[model samples]
Target: MKFTEGMWRLREGIRIDWMNNVERLRVENENVELLLNKFQRHRGDTLNSATVTASVTSPLEGIIGVKLVHWAGQVDNGPHYQLASSSGHTKINHEKTETLSYDSGALNLAINTAPNELDFVFSGAKGKLTGHSWRSIGYVGDQTTEKSQWDDGIFFERQGYMLAALDLGVGEKLYGLGERFGPLVKNGQTVDIWNEDGGTSSELAYKNIPFYVSSKGYGVFVNHPGKVSFELQSERTTRVNISVPGEELEYFIIYGETLKEVISRYTALTGRPSLVPSWSYNLWLTTSFTTNYDEQTVTGFLDGFRDRDIPLGVFHFDSFWMKSYQWCDFEFDEELFPDAGGYLKRLRERDLKISVWINPYVGQASPLFQEGKKNGYFIKRTDGSVWQWDLWQAGMAVVDFTNPDACTWFSNHMQRLMDLGVDTFKTDFAERIPYKNIQYHDGSDPARMHNYYTLLFNKVVYEAMISRYGKSNSLLFARSSCPGGQVYPVHWGGDCESTYEAMAESLRGGLSLMLSGYIFWASDIGGFEGTPPPALYKRWVQFGLLSSHSRLHGSSSFRVPWIYGEDCSDVLRDCVKRKILLTPYLLAEALAGYNEGTPVMRPMFLEFPEDLNTYPLDTQYMFGSNLLVAPVFTDEGTVTFYVPHTPEDSQGKWVSWFDHSKTYEPGQWYTETHGFDTLPILIRPGSVTPINPKLKAPQDDALNGLEVLVNGSLANDMAVQVVNPSKTHNVLKVIKIESQSGNVTADDAGVKVVRIGH
Candidate 1:
């Protein structure tokens, strides 16, 4: 993806034609077009050279999209990212021979048209954000010449690439390239936007989205489905170089007054995260992969949680549910689960939901594989044979979701499971798709479908679930995703090792994904690769239960809490109870995420955009708009976290949720040691959190025993929306609380009020 060796020279076998001057400019309504050619000195300079055609338009109110094309004759196949657009919101101005500007809301794109100088400058309400200047836009050719047997038969094959570089301002930090695990700040990093199955320890990511939010109150989304490479301050040190191997490169510049508003607009263009069911917020226990488990083993795990007085929500059956070597058969192993339907019915009677594991692969041993091969329902090679690989399963063939009949065939199998009382599915492993010498049934470009395969795979299964269950109850614990995949709720960080470092990385990945327009995210509670030590398990349990979704899963060992120690179970029970009490507040945040694209688990900068101290702090995050959660990473239970100062807080203070008497001033850092039962959960000033202490499960009515917990003094009366747990986006009531004489009282006489700090 790197084309230059340094500033002065290009790499071998590379030729780049940078856009130097605009030869002609045309405006049609709100759309602008430009014909850019190389530096023009005279009429002789215009012969036999490459030129780039640029088109600019506004997709949304505050977004401007630019497409640079090197060649307009190449055919563009299918597999494009879905974008929402609106018209009649743009204003265009053309000043004679000097400058041309296009305005979308408060964001403006200005082109400098003075004779040999062509530059594109983007400005917002807060002055210039970023722009293209110097050697910023170019078309590159990578070629190799070969000689044939005859001396005259010499030929060259060249791969064309279009690139655009945008200016990076001083101290501007970038984030959210899709669940990255390296660092929260994306400066000095070369990121390749390709989906892979690599674990949490590598730069390779399972979810690679080509959208990034900047610290400068703006964001850029590269509108490509295929591989888009980004050199973030690594190549030029002051530019974000974006290159794609094709005829054209399209990107959108989104601007807002704040970072949260920028993300809101980005998600509006891509897709908004769907609201997941409330019970999914509770604890989920899974049968660990490769562990010896049958119906009896699953029963014992359930019994263990019940005997220890721990509340459970969903019980998941991992890959072993089906026979070995037959993954997508969708039938229970007769040797292990003789009466699968009866067992699921009994679990349903006990008020538990059932989730089973599945992938978009049909192994050769599965009966459906032969059916699919005969019907041409799988991805095929040029010879019209199914593409097979022996990586995860024997002779595994990827199901072609592009074919309508193939999608129906796959969904019918899922429907059979739904008839047996399965409530949801853990859609896993669509990242390892083949892109070379393969063809989709719908004739989509293979390279483009490589990352887009997960979207189709999850959509098929998610729609199946919605058909069986209503939209309010449909959910998927998906593993891989792309740009518009947020419409299918609930994805998790995949395949982490059982260690404190991996636990911290999982948190970093989840926080990064939330910033990418995903609302609900989880990780393997105690990690997934190896058995976790008791200390690590207890710490991870606390962190996992606080997330939007919680699950306990591992690779070789069972994730049952009592397997570690009695203390682990006690700590997990307390965390689960606390989460159940916090469900009323969490549901409100989920509604915001669904309605406005505001993430439930937010980075600190998203909440306090004006506070410079909050920009670099990824170790902690705002649980919603109010509570700050700093997970204890070390076994010693020592953590240092920061509290930010805001104008909303009169006293500029934060109160600890654990010890209500303990308070800390804002704009300072504090280090504290906690036991296994506690970490730092601080409530921001002037916030009221609704709690239901008597609720046993998240499915229970949250309004039954709701109590408003006021954190600090309220300058004015605040209204809190109490959400109904069973329905989506349904508000049961809004409780109005009046703050008088350092004490708060609710308007509803039946609701109890609890005050934390005065």
Candidate 2:
């Protein structure tokens, strides 16, 4: 994807034709088109050779979309991100001359019809936001001429690449390249927007969304579902370069004064994340992968949580549910689970939801594989053979989600499981889709369908759940996703090591996911590959329980608290209870994510945009808009974090939710030591935090006996919405607690209001 060598020369066989001048400009209906000619001297020189036709239009109120085309006609097979709403012919006010100016909302785009440049400057109510200059547009041609063709002039096969580079201002940082695990600030990094099954330890991401938000209060989303290679300050050092493999590349520029508004607009174009069921927020216990487990194993895991006094919500059955070498057979292993339905029924009677594992693959040993191959339900190769690979399963053939019959065939299998008391499916491994020399049944481009496959795969399963169990109860524990895949409720971080570093990286990945518009995210509590040490296990328990969704899963070892130590059980119990108590606040945040595209686990910059220090602080995040959670990553149970002091921040003192004696001032770094039972969860000043003591399940009706704990000084009116116990409705509760000279006066609606600090 890198085209240049160092700062000067092109690498190997790379050729770049930078559009330098615009020959003609005109407006047709809702689009503005420009006929761009490469460096030309005389009028006759612009007659032939390759030229770029650039079209500019407004897709949303404050979003401007630009598409650059090199070839006139090219077959576009299908697969594009689905936009939630249409722009519907937005009014464009233009002033024509040698230099034409067009304005949409507060976004002003100036086109130099004579020179080769397109500039976008946005001025909102908060003044100048961000701009993309013309020097960033590029049409690259990569070709290698044979030695014989050099003299004969016969070789002309050149791969077309369209690249768009936007200006990166001083001190500007980029975030959200779809659940990245490295540093949060995406500067000096070359990111390829291609989905892969790489674990959370590397630069390769399972969910590579073609979208990013800048600290300068704007976002750019590439419309291409295929690979989008981005050079974030790595290629040009001052500009973020985006390259797509086609003659035409389309992208949208969204404007907002704050990162939250940028996310709102971005999610509005793509879809907003749907609300997950309330019970999903509770603790989930899973049968560890590759571990010997059956009905007795599952029963023991559930009973272990209950015996340890841990509040359990959902129980997940990993890949071993089906017979080996026959994934997607959708049948319980007769040797292990003889009575799958009866066992699941008994678990449901205990008020615990059941989730089973599934993937869009049918191994050759599977009974359904021959049927799928004969019915043309699997992806086919160029030679018309069914695509088969032996990576995860023996001769596993991927389901062709592009085919309607194939989707129905797959969904019917999942629907049958749901009918047998299964509440959810942990849809996994859609990231390993084939793209080379493969064809989709519906004629979708293989490259585009690679990442978009998850969108369809999860959609089929999610809709099946919605059909079986209404919209309020539908959920999928999905793994891979793309731009619009946030519509599905829950996605967890993929395989991770059982170490403190992996735990921290998981948090980093989850935080990055929030920036990418994903609402609820989870990971293996003590990592996925190996069993975590006792210290790391206890620490991960606190962090995992605080996450939007919590699950205990591992590969070779059981994640039962007793496996780690007796102290781990106490830690798990304490963290689960604390998270359950904080359910009212967390559910309110989840509702906001569903309705307004605001992420429940937010990066610090989203809450305090003006504070420059918050840009690179990925170690900590705002759980909702008030509580700051900084997970301890070391064995000593120590953490170092910063509390930003900005005008928009709460105007009172910072209060530690743990020991009331341990309080800190804002705008400073704080290092604190915690025991296995304590984690640093700081509440912002002037915030009203709602809590539910004696918490049970997520559907427990705690609203009738809710406790509104006033954190710091409730200097302003605060409100929190708690979902009804029946999971039917969200009840909005408002409290006005004015901060007097030193005392606070509260207006309570029969709910206990307790102040946190003196």
Candidate 3:
């Protein structure tokens, strides 16, 4: 992806023809088309070589879109991300002597029209955020005449790359590239938007979205489902370079005065996160992958949670639920689950939702493989044969979701499982899709389909659930995603080791995901690859309980509390109980996500955008607009965190939710010591957090008795919305907790107000 060794010279075999000047501009009704030439001396200078044409349009209010093309022979096949609007209402005008400008709502774009120069600047309400200048746009190619070792014909086609470099300002930072596990700041990183199955330890990401927001108050979204190579201050120190392998590249420049607004607009253009079931916010227990478990082991684990008084919502069955090497047969292993229907009935009778793991793979050992191949349900190679590989399963073929009958075939299998009482599907492992010589059913671009396949894969299962159970009851435990994948509810961090470091990395990934328009995210509680020690297990329990969704899972060992130590049971119980108690509050935040595109687990910068300190801080995050959760990530239980504040905001107070007697002022760093049972959870100032302390199950209709905790002074009246299990908020009965005046009242309801720090 990097084309240069350093600033001075290009890397070997790389040839770039940069866009030097705009030769002529043609104005249209909604857009402007510009023909670009490399040389500006004479008309005949545009002889035997390359030329570029750019189409500028606006897809939404305050969003500028530019599509640059170098060749016309590329096919229009697509697995394109569904844009909410193709184009917005636009206005265009030009000055006679110098420039041509386009305005869409508050965003404005101006292009300098001088003979030998091409400068495009994007400005929001405040001023110019970023722009393209000089030789920033380019058509790149690898001119290696040597034959490819894999195939001689492969090198004959001169596949070109389209690249654009947007100017970056001094001290500007970049964030959000779809659940990255590396640094929170994206500078000095070469990020390629390619989905891979590599675990959380590596640069490969399961969800690689081609969009990023800058600290300079704008966002750039590469409008390609294919791989987008980004050099964020790496190849070029002062610019963020974006490149895609194709004849054309298109990108959208969205402007917002605040970063939160930027995310809102971006989500509006792509898709907003769907509202998941409220019960999904509760604790989930899984049959750990690769662990020896049968009906007895499963019943014992459920009974163990009941015996310990832990409130569990959903129980998941991992890959071993199906017969070995026969995944996607969608049948429970007969030896392990002889009475699959009756066993699921018993679990449902116990008020537990059932989730089973499923991928889009049809293994050759299974009967579904032949059915899929015969019906053209599997992805095919160019030679008209089903593509098979031995990576995860022997002779596995990926299901081609582009085929309608294939989708129907897969959905019917899921519906059969639903008839057996499976509540949700953990849609997993589409990140390893093959790209070489692949042929989709609908002739989609294979490069684009590599990442977009997960979107369609999750969508097929999600829609099946919705068709069966209705939207309110639908949810998915997806492992891979793309830009529009937020339409599905929940995604988990993939394959992390059982360590505190892995836990921290998981949090970083989750926070990064939230910034990328994903509302809900979870991870393996005791980690996925190995068993965590008692200390790490207990700490992870607390952290996971606070997340939007929690699941106890492991790779080789069962994640039951007793496996670590006896005390872990208590830690797990307390956290699960607390999570259940906070369900009303959490579900309200989930509603906020659906309505506003705000992430429930928000990074600190989203909450406190004016404070520069919060930009790179990923250790702590705000759980909704209130509660700040600083997860304890070390063995010693020592913690350090910062509370952001400006001059006018310094007078506010941060009250500790765990220790009522402890309070801290804003705008300073604080350190503390604690046991495994406690971490730093602080309620922000001017907020009213509703708590349902006596709830035993997440689905219980227990909003009748509510305890409101008022933090600091609510300069204005604070109202907390109580929503039911359904999507509707109970607007008739409102709870008002008056601050600066210790008066609290409810609209003829049983609500109690407790003042924490007045």
Candidate 4:
């Protein structure tokens, strides 16, 4: 998607038309209409003239919207949020000097137009916001379907586009591109906001978002469902360049006082995340991909864990639940599962939820393929043929989510599965969608369909559960996503290699994605690509158990704890018990995450935004607002993490939960080595983090034995809540921590604050 020749000149066969002049300005009430062009077109050129009509208006005091329309007949079935805060009435007035400005509540949207330049500056009662300036808007094109060895004429099409990128400040760092597994700081990276299945070790991502936030306290969201390219200090080193193929590009500039507010407002615009079931936060065990297993085999594994006294939550049945080449038939292989519903019921009777793997694929051998083709429920090529691909399955066709009938048909299949006690669907393989020579019922652009397809797929399945089990009980173990995909809860890192390097890479990716505003994260506990040594599995289990969501899955092998030997079960039990004990604290964190779009498993910068070292540190992350979790990525248990100096939490009271004998400081780095049992976990100063020493994840009685640890003499009160994932805060123990008055408690809630220098 890079159109530059060595970052200097435009490539060959490329044509760019930057808006040089605003030829005419017509004002109608609060709306201003302007005609933008490259040059004047004569009568002979009128038919092929490339001109754009931009409509601009101020909907609120600090908000401006520009809707660029090329084809008026297109439907805008908008999935946008209704503005909660609508400001003053807008007024547009034109001056004699050819400058048209809209005035509203001391905020002015001035359109300074002349022969070769245009500028829209927004300054208001509160502050100054971002806008466009000289040569900022452009329409560019490249010979697409004309000549390309990459794809056939049926695939690539001649494409024209609009592009823009705003300037970056001296110390500004960019964040959030939807669960990226790269550097936490997005600078020096060339990202395509296109979802793909490139795994954790590559530049490609499964969840790509066209929106990104900055350390300077603003967010930019590209309003495109297509593959939008971002050059974050990669092309120019001082700007975030955004480009999308089409006639026009529009982006929103969101402003807020803090980074968290920016995310809350942004999610408010796109969609709020579905509140996941409290049990969904517990560790999930699965039958790995391409592994052979049956009821006896699965029961043996479950019994093995039970014998070891390790708690098991939801169990997942991966692919191969169906016969080979019959994927998405929505029927369990009767050979393996003679009584599917009865067996699932038995499993659920043991107090476990059930999840199964499914994708939107219709293989040739599947009975539903012909039915879909006959009913036009599958995506079709230009020649009236079903778009068939042999990548994952032999002659598999994708369900056209743009087709309402197809969505209904797909949902019916899911309902059948849910009727059999399948609590959730592992909605996987959405990244490899077709983007060319395809027709949609809604006539949506195919390029846009590539990323938007996942949104539709997850939505359809999520809604199916809502109809059947209700909204509060719905969830998905999705592997791919887009900007709006955050509306679905839990997404995992796909197909990582079984190595320490890949483990670290997974953490980096999770942290990167967390900064992009995803709340829940999970990964293959013992690795997926190869068999790991006992050390690796044990280490990975500890890290995975600490995540907001955890899963044990693999490829070509079973990821059961005993597969690595009985010692691995001990590791699982240890970590799972601790995670259960930490539930009271984690649940409160999840609730706080709802109001502010912070991830339950967070990047270090989110908790310590001022520390420059924290900006690039991705190896470690915060479990919530309090505990710092540094997962041991190596076979050796060496650990390193940063502590920020906060006015509320000073150095003296920082305590290690594992060893109360050891203490740390603020604004410094700590290195320690331990046995296979522990990783680095620290409590910040003046932190009133709660804990429940039990092996249960969800409970209504949170007032029992609430243990609150006060880190230091904090100047402010740290409110303590021992509640579940429903976001209802219960003050089991509320105390005021101060350097002046000391720790004052309202009740005997087993709260303790070891005074620093005591």
Looking at model 1, report the run of 10 residues with the lowest lDDT sum. Answer: 144-153
The collision pairs in model 1 are: none
Off by over 4 Å in 1: 144-155, 739-747
TM-score computed on alpha carbons, candidate 4: 0.89
Clash pairs of candidate 4?
179-513, 181-509, 686-712
Could you give candidate 1's per-residue lDDT for residues 117-225 as a string of tens digits?
8999999988999999998999998874332123444444467889999999999999999999888888999999999999999999999989999999999999999
Highest TM-score: give the candidate number: 1
Candidate 3, 49: how far from true, in Å?
3.3
In candidate 4, what are the lDDT values of residues 1-758, reduced to their tens digit? 55666545887867666665577878876777888765444545434546667787554443456655433454544333233345446777777436777765454567777555567665444444545665555666677545443555556434666667566767778887876777778899999888888888888998887778877666777777887899887876666777876666666666566667667767766666556777776778999998999899888888887788888888999999999999989999999999999999999888888999999998999999999999999888978899998888899999988889899999998898888999999999899988778777677767778888888999899998989977667789999987767778778988898888888888877876776667788889888899888889988998899898889999998888787888788889889888877777777777666656777887777777667677777788888987888878767788877776665544455678787667777788988876678888887766666666643655434555456666656666555655544433333434444546456465643554444322
Off by over 4 Å in 2: 6-8, 85-93, 116-135, 145-155, 646-651, 732-748
CA lDDT of each prediction against the hidden true structure: 0.91, 0.82, 0.87, 0.75
Sorting all predicted structures by lDDT, with the top scorer first, yields 1, 3, 2, 4
Better of 2 and 3 by TM-score: 3
Ranking by TM-score: 1, 3, 2, 4
**How many clashes (backbone atoms < 3 Å, residues ≥3 apart in a chain or on different chains) does model 1 have?**
0
Best by lDDT: 1
Q: Give the winner by lDDT: 1 or 4.
A: 1
**Structural similarity to truth (TM-score) of each candidate:** 0.98, 0.96, 0.97, 0.89
Which window of ten consecutive residues has the lowest lDDT sum in model 3? 145-154
